[model samples]
Target chain A: MLNIAVIEDDKYYRKDIAGHLSRFGKVDEGKSLSDAITLFDARKYDIVFIDLNLSGKMEGLDVIKEAVKRKIPPIVITGYTSEKLVSRAYQLGCKHYYNKLDIQNSFEEQMAPFLRSLVYKQEDDIFSNSFVTRNNILIKNIKLVTEQMFLKNNKVFITGEKGVGKTTIAKFIHKFSTGSMDSFIHVDIPTLENNMIEPLLFGYKKGAFAGASDDFKGLIKQADKGTLFLDEISSLPPSLQKKIIKVVEDKQFYPLGSDQLIKSDFRFITSTNENVEGLIESERLRPDFYFMAKDVELIIPPLRERVEDVRPLVDHYINKSGTSLLVSNDSLKLLENYRWHDNVRELKKLIHSFCNCNTEMISLINLPEHVIENTIPSGQSTPLASVYTKGISNFIKKHGLKKLIETIEIESFKEFYEKNHFHYMNTLEELHISRTAGYRIKANIKKLDKERHLVH
Target chain B: MFTDKEKLLHDLNGNIVRLGSIFNILNKIENSKDQEISKNEMNQMLEDAEQTAILLNNDIKTFISINMNN
Candidate 1:
């Protein structure tokens, strides 16, 4: 069972929280900040519940700040109606927030499932048992590259297909490197339109713009000494890209309407689904920025490559939703075979919807038709016989056929080789191999060509 | 089962609550004194409230012994 701590000044509210949370796990109660701290030091609690207003010497914010400093996951339970305080609680890494007034009505529904999922219990000590040098979560080579980027004092360029967890990997880098229990400021470039980009990145001084009453510190300054993760970096306008390059290179930037230059020392971790080489070739992304970023680059593979992770992902979602659900082998196969164009994010949403809508048991009949339909090749398209004639015809005459066949397993190699008939690029496209894999195959072919020459 | 120490702790917590009520009342009087009463009287009341709040917090904390039961 998970161990939890509840800190609230109100006696009734504190007892109510303990009663509700006890249904899921063991909960210890503390009526003040001092009591809470003493209890925290005594044992390892999975989650902590903190109230924003307390009657004692210490305020609730003090408790939250202390919890954050101690690297504890805090859930803010407040009675205050101020939006500013609620937003600040979230900014300080309070995963869940609830109002005290509504505790009687919404306490169990909100806190129970959240408490269950918040506890990061180890299924087993895989990290210690496993020979892998990296953390347990980052098992793939692509994740290792991202972790290396975090260790090095350099900007990283993360490229992957959309929904392929590029941003998730970036967040992992941020969490590992900073060692601070603070939220990573995620900025999507496309979300900030051309007119808002400058103000969003660089704070505006008081009266800098019309109707400006107070000085504003932009996301960059706020994320100082932490990570400023720029998602969709390729979508940033040319002007902003130039400014970003300067700031990233120099670690100094002037705020809007400020004559004095401000320096912010923040790590820049950028991710884009666009092809970096293609972007540079089209003159959309700056070559100099690309070169600077090339030193630490991580290319996240699409979900199809890591089919082994699918079952775990499904289990993760089921556990996340706190629901008892099962997926049949056929349904699992359908999920695995389908082209996950949207990636993990889409899969998570689908699972969440299923858990919320469906009852206890989720079988093949209950599963969505689209999920099964999209997965089967025959369901959506004509049969393979009608599409293309399948036969081995003149293998030697086919250009690059031998090289393409060598890259793949011998069993399926001949089938795809004959299907594409000599066109290496078409084979790569049909098989959904990334451009990097294709280039590697091309390099191997060149090496083979030299060896053949020497033999002749 | 309530031990002698737990009983003492509960009584101390009750006293702290009583002291907090007194402090809140004095604070209100002090706030109103600035408009109607003299400056010296307001200052004296404010000091009394602050001292009372600190003493109550300290005494109650000592009575409870945060790690007593745990």
Candidate 2:
């Protein structure tokens, strides 16, 4: 039987709802907010019907908000209704709002569908899609897309910070979507060589280039009757944007250096870590191309916004690391507070490193030095240093180790100078450089400062 | 003088509970034995509605304030 909570102050109305609801399941009645909260803490309930106004106050709506925070959607029943109140209730994750006075017959007239859903516990709905997340917002968004857009083979665009699991969600959609076997094709645009992107996307004819050998089948054709996931789509060259738009529009494209067009039927899903709107405005991503898959855009929120997911993610990573260790609450708190610039991937790496150390129990001491040092105090942000470090790491990785020391020296010199009240001696001491080298560093800083000013 | 999410929520919840009482009074008037509402009863209903509106507005503002500060 379904477990239900009813929070209504009116004795007669509470009895009316409870009497009807009792026929289907156990009903717990709460005449006040405190009683409702106490009942909520005792155990989980399948559903909650919260009166929007209780006694002479709006405590019932507050109870509804609390239920939503616990990932339980509550049906709001109010004696009076206003647009703002209804909208707010929905925003708090309520699925149904009933004006108590609108009932023509018994409460069952308005509640039959909800009761049936609870009784059957159907798995066919979007909520059953196993995307491996506890975030209600993300779950709701995924459910909406799967229910409304997936079956129609509509193009989907997933965007979020790098390593925020956009590609995983795409794979999940592909797995559940009806399609041909071995049809999930993923093309990493950033990894594709600039000179060979076209040939990789569209097959090249023999002798198309000086070193061309045999004919090559492009990814589009290979993904026929299946899903093609274009990852980091924002990195795709502008020259190819129109061609991609054309392919999406017509489902047909000619191989490189060929006169005949080849038709291929495939579903398209694209993901990007870059700001697509900015890219479109700058003419980097074609407007038509962007709009082709814009109907079902899913933005996976950054980890920091969904902090509740952090503990489960950490547990998942630890379990995957194959280390039999329990993460302390303190360590989890530290991990949660640290800005996840690299998102889930970074958290996994941290857990993997801890496993490498073979620790029986992971605590605050096991956290990475940078993460520990950069953990922002509650309500205060100290982000610049860590963000700068991440930027420098990416720059070094992309540009090779050449001029590494000089880059570090210049950055450190500037950082210390700016942060230390422009103390020349302090900056020099921090860098372990003499006056001659210091003059060169100062010149470099001035040059960098002038370049930054000009760019702005 | 109230501060923090829990306190603010508590304050709003109290106001809404009071507002619910006003709604209950209006409901009683609407379902009274007489088929038609008297002018005095209608005026009382209107007054109750006004009070409910003020309380609801205060509750909404409190929620907005909490969101902004957070």
Candidate 3:
């Protein structure tokens, strides 16, 4: 049975909902905002039904926000039906919104099926794909895509930060889709050239353009019966976005300079690190295309937010490497503390780098200087260092040890001059350097600024 | 003071819907005469919706005050 919470200020409405929902789950009631929050932290809830207005305040929004942080979706059962209210509810991670008048009917149709689907999706046992994540929300969404999108042959739009496994999820969807053995073509939007994007994607007949000497096949034709994952689709030019929408709708397109139309059936899965709504608001993406692509949307949380997955991911990567090297607790703690800016991809890279250590165990001493620099030490008052030594280390790695010596000297000379309030003679004498050498150091420091801003 | 007419509409819409729901419950209890709902519970639901309406009314008044420059 589901553990459901009803957070409606109306005791009558609360009792009504709780009374009905009790048949499906263990029902809890929260008559006020503080009561709702207290009940929420008391246990893990399978679902929460929240009113948009509670106790004469917009406290329901706060409850929804808190639920989203815990990776649980809140179902809005407010009486309000305004577009703006509905939009805010969805933005705050509500999957369903029901107006109050039709509560009994909605429960019979929408709510019961939804709960059964959640149960059905979990018990399917289809998470053996390589997109390994222990996050409950990610697992739930993956199950949803497999059960809904793949079975229905619908499109899925994924949104997440870079390296957070959006593409991996797309591939996992393809593996379970109808044409599982067919091609899985990945099209990266940023790599498309402005002048050649059209011909590159839709192919070209002989003599279509000046350089089009031979017939060419494109991305769409390549994925004849399988999946086509469009990465960072918001970067696609608006004109091209419109054309792709037609191809998606009709499943038929003409190659450049060809009168005949070609048909290709392909499953569509698109992803972007950028905000889709923001892109549409700015008129960068067509609303029609957004509607077509967003049949089922899945969002992956960044690795930093789901830190519990770090140890399992590390172990998985290590076991996959065909070697058994244990991670020392100190090293593991540092790894856990370090903010993984690049998500799972960065973690994989860290593990890949560890293989070169040739040591039996990964210890504190074997960790990279930059990784150690980013990690926060326990029980320490000082924040992660603003001046990370990682930049200096990267500079040495990119340039050489020689450049490191020059950079240190330049910094030393500049520090002396600034400390002496730009008295050139006094500062140069204090550093025991000639005026000419000091001038050279000053020029070198200026050159360094022109080259790049180090020490981020 | 409300800068966004859209947001003000949303706040008003929420309260209006609450009042609508309260009225519907009151009507159901009156017409059916079989609702097991408590009379005190119905009174508090109405009171809660009224408080929301009053808050939204003040918001609209503030919006008018700012616009009229009174």
Q: Please give the ranking of all candidate structures by lDDT, highest first, separated by commas.
A: 3, 2, 1
Model 2: share of true interface contacts reproduced? 0.00
lDDT of 3 by residue, A240-264 (tens): 9999999989999999999888888
User: If ranked by DockQ, best first, what sequence of candidates would result?
Assistant: 3, 1, 2
TM-score winner between 1 and 3, please give it.
3
What is the docking quality class of candidate 2? incorrect
Report how far off residue A398 is in candidate 1 (Å). 38
lDDT of 1 by residue, A38-61 (tens): 977876666788876677332777
**Chain B TM-score for each model?**
0.47, 0.53, 0.69
What would the per-residue lDDT of candidate 2 be over residues B1-70, giving only the tens digit for each residue? 2245555565455445445545554565567664365798678757765766786787789789868988
What stretches of model 2 exceed 4 Å from their correct place? A1-131, A179-182, A378-456, B1-70
- Deviation (Å) of A121 in candidate 2: 7.2
Write down the RMSD of all candidates, one decimal each: 17.4, 20.4, 20.1
1 against 3, candidate with superior lDDT = 3
User: Which pairs of residues have clashing backbones in candidate 1?
Assistant: none
lDDT of 2 by residue, A181-226 (tens): 3388899999988988889898878998866798888899998877
Best by DockQ: 3
Supply candidate 2's per-residue lDDT for B46. Answer: 74
How well does candidate 3 reproduce the true complex, by DockQ?
0.06
